[model samples]
Target: MTAEVPTTPPGDAAATREASERGGLPGAVDPPAGGGEAHAASDSALARVVREESGRIVAALTASLGNLDLAEESVAEAVEEALREWRVRGIPPRPGAWLTQAARHNALDRMRRDRRYREKLALLAGATVPTAGEVDERLPLIFGCCHPALSPDAQLALTLRAVCGLTTAQIARATLASATAVGQRIVRAKRKIGAAGIPIRIPEGDDRADRLDLVLTVVSVMYSEAHLVAGRDAAADRDLADDALWLSGVVAAALPREAEAHGLHALLLFHRAREGARAVDGELVLLGDQDRGRWDAALLSEAHRTLESAARLRRSGRWQLHAAIAACHADASSSAATDWLQVLTLYDMLLRYDRSPVVRLNRAVALAAVEGPVEALAEVDSLESALAGYHLWHAVRAHLLRLLGRDAEATAADLRALDLTDNQAERRLIVARLAR
Candidate 1:
C-alpha cells in the first residue's frame, strides 16, 4: 500500500462497471470514471472502495491528523496515486485496507514536505486506524457539515464530500449544479467552519432539531438520487443506497428518542423493500406495473415496525407522513387495490409540512387516480414555472396528458422530460412512450 515502495501488484480481480449515467446537474461533465477508466476492473474497484469507505477513512484520518484539511487532501492525493499505481499493479485484495494504508503514508509524506502540516507529523506518526467498534465519526461529521450557519447548498456539498465520500463532480450532478459552483461552496463552507469554529459533532437538546432536520433531508436526497438519477452502474447506485440506509440507521440509533429519526429509517426501508421490483433488466417499471411479488417481505415488515415505533412517539413530522404514504402503497395487494382516497388524504396533510411544487406534483398523481387525469393535469400545470428544470415534473405531466388522450401534448412533454434526464432507465421509459 506504500506508494513510494516498489511492490508486486495484486493479481487481477473482476472489476465492476464504471458509472455511466450522464447528464450533469445543471451543467455537468460526463459522469466521472469514478475510479478512472484507465485500468478497467482495477480502477473501477478502486473507485467503488473509495466511495464506500471514504467517510470511515476521512473520520480516522481527521481524528489522527487533527486537521480536516490535511485529511481530505491526503485522501485525494492517495486516490490520484492509486489511479496510476493500481493500473500498473492489479488492485489489492483488500481494497479498503490498502487504500487506508496508502492514505496514511500519503499523509505522512505530506507532513514531511508541506510546511503547514509539519508540526502535525508527530501525531500522524503515532496515529493508528480506528478499530471497527470505536466511535464512528461519520454521523458527527454529517451533523457538523450541516451546521445552520452554512447555507443549505453548502451543507449538502460538505456532507456528500466528507461523510458520503462523493467527489465534487458527483455531488454537482446530484444537486443539478455546475462543478465550479459546488467546489466553491465546499471551500467557502470549510473556511466558515474553521473561522467560526462551528462544531462538527451533533448538538445537544433543543438546538439538535434544526441540524437533524437538515441531516435527514440530505440523507433522503442521497437515497432518492441513487434511484432517480440515471446511471449504468447499478452496483454503484446500490452501494450508495446501502450507505444512505446505514446513515439513517446510525442517526436513528444515536437519537432513539427522536421521532423523525425512526421515521426516516422507516421511510428508507419502505423504499428499499420495493427496490427489487422497481425495474426489470434496466427498464423502468411504473409503480402500477412493478412486480409486487419481488418486494422484500422482511424489509417491509421491518419498515412497518419502525413506522409503528415512530407513531408511538406521538410526534407528527414530515418523515412519518411520507412513511405513511409509502405504507399505503406497500400495504396494497395490487396497484388498483390501493386506496387512492387515503393516499390523497396523506398528501393533503403533507401539504402542511411541505408545500413545495414536487409535493404538489406527487399529490397530482393521486388526483389522477381519484379525480381523473383532467384534474391532475390542471394541478401539474400550475407547477410548470417552479418545476420546469426537474425531469419528474415533465414525466408525470406526460403520463397524465397521455391518460387524457392528449397524445400530441404528451409527446412534447415526454420529449422535454427526456432532455432533462440522462439516466438510461428513465430515458428508456420515455423512449418507449415515443416508440409506442
Candidate 2:
C-alpha cells in the first residue's frame, strides 16, 4: 500500500487550527475536503512537503534557474500548479520528481519570455539536470539565505521563504508579526541580495563557521518560539520547532567539527522532549506543575544522549550549558526534586559566555529556585533597566515579589508585563497569575 500524503492550506483557519492541534508540525495535519480546506492542505503541503524531498526539489530548481530568486519563484509556481492539478488527477507517485520537472519547465518558460535572460538561460541549459540524490547540493542555498550579512530577523524570514517554502503570512504568524511586515522584510532582503550580487554558493573555512552561527541562531529562535507555545498549537503545525531541529541537525551533520552546532542540536532536542507536558486541558502548565510522566520518554532519552555526547567534546558553549541545564531538569522525577543548584551553576556558566538581558532573566528564575525569591528579586532588579520593555522580566519580577509578600508591587509588575506582551496566551497566563 502507498503511504498517505499529508497536506494543509496556508492561512485556512480550520487548517491552522488543525495544525495547531498537531503541535504545529506542518504536513502532519490532514487537509479538510473542499470548501477551501483542500487549498489549505495544499498550502501546508507546499510549505512542508519540500522537507521530504528538499534535496531533489532545491537542486533541480537551482540548477534550472541559476539565480536563487528565480529558482525560488519557479519552485513556488510549481507547487501552485500541483495544488491545481492534483485536486483532479490526485498526487503523483513520484511527487518530488514531478515538482522538479514542473519547476524546471516554469523557469524555462520565464527565461524564454525575458529578452535579457539569454546568458542566464544558456548557463542553465548547459548545466546538468540534477537527480534526486544531488539535492544535497542545495544545502548551500540554505546557508546563503540565512547569511550573517542580513539581520537576524531578515535571515529567518528569508530562510523560511526560500528554504522552507513558507508564505509571508505563515512566516508572520509563526513569528507573531503582521503579514505586511513580513512581506516587506522578505522583499527588502531579496532586493539586498540582488543589489549586492550575493553568490548563492556556500562559504568555506572561517567564513562558513561565521555564517553557520547565524543559521543556528535563526533555528534556535524558531525552536524557542515553538516550545513557548507547544500546548496552544496543534502538533502538525509545530513545524517551527521541527524545522529548527531539522536545520540544526543538518548543520551538525554537515559540520561535524563544530561543537556549537552539536550544542544547538542537543539544546533543541532536550527542550522538545518537554513539549508534550507543557499544557493540560488547553491551559499552560508551568514547568513546576507539569507531570514528569507526561513527558516523551524517547525524546527525553535522545536529548540526554545528545547532551552527553556534546559534553564529552568538552566545549563550554552557551548551547551546551543550556542543554546540560535542561537535561538536569529532565533527570528529575518531579519539579521539587530538580537540582536547582546545578541548574544555577549552568546558568552562571551560560551568563559568563553570553550576558544578554534574556539570559540574565532566565538566570534570575534559576536563582529564585535555588537562593529564594528575595535573592531572585534582587537579580531581576538588576536587569530592570536593560530589560525595561521585556514582558518576561516584569513577569518574573511579579512572581518573585508576590512570593515575598509584596502584593501591591506584584500586581503592578504583572500589569506591566500584560501591557508589554503581545502573545494572547502568555498575557492570559500572566493575568491569571496576578489574580492569584
**lDDT of the candidates, in the order given:** 0.73, 0.66
lDDT of 2 by residue, 1-436 (tens): 0000000001221122234345443334344565355555545564455544443455445544546667766765676676667655666777767777787788888989997777777776666545544434556777877766677778777776666555565566455457788778787887787667666667899878767766666566555545333233323336656766777787778877777788888877876777677755555566777788888888888887776776777776877877787788888998789898998998898877778776777778878888888888888899777767656677778888888989999899889978865545566677777666
For model 1, the stretches where C-alpha displacement exceeds 4 angstroms are 1-38, 112-122, 131-135, 228-236
Q: Clashing residue pairs, candidate 1?
A: 15-41, 25-176, 26-176, 230-423
TM-score of 2: 0.77
TM-score of 1: 0.86
Candidates' RMSD to native: 8.8, 7.3
lDDT of 2: 0.66
lDDT for residue 422 in candidate 1, whole number 0-100:
68
Runs in model 2 deviating more than 4 A are 1-60, 63-66, 82-99, 122-138, 148-153, 165-185, 227-236, 381-390, 415-428
Top candidate when judged by TM-score against the true structure: 1
Per-prediction TM-score, please? 0.86, 0.77
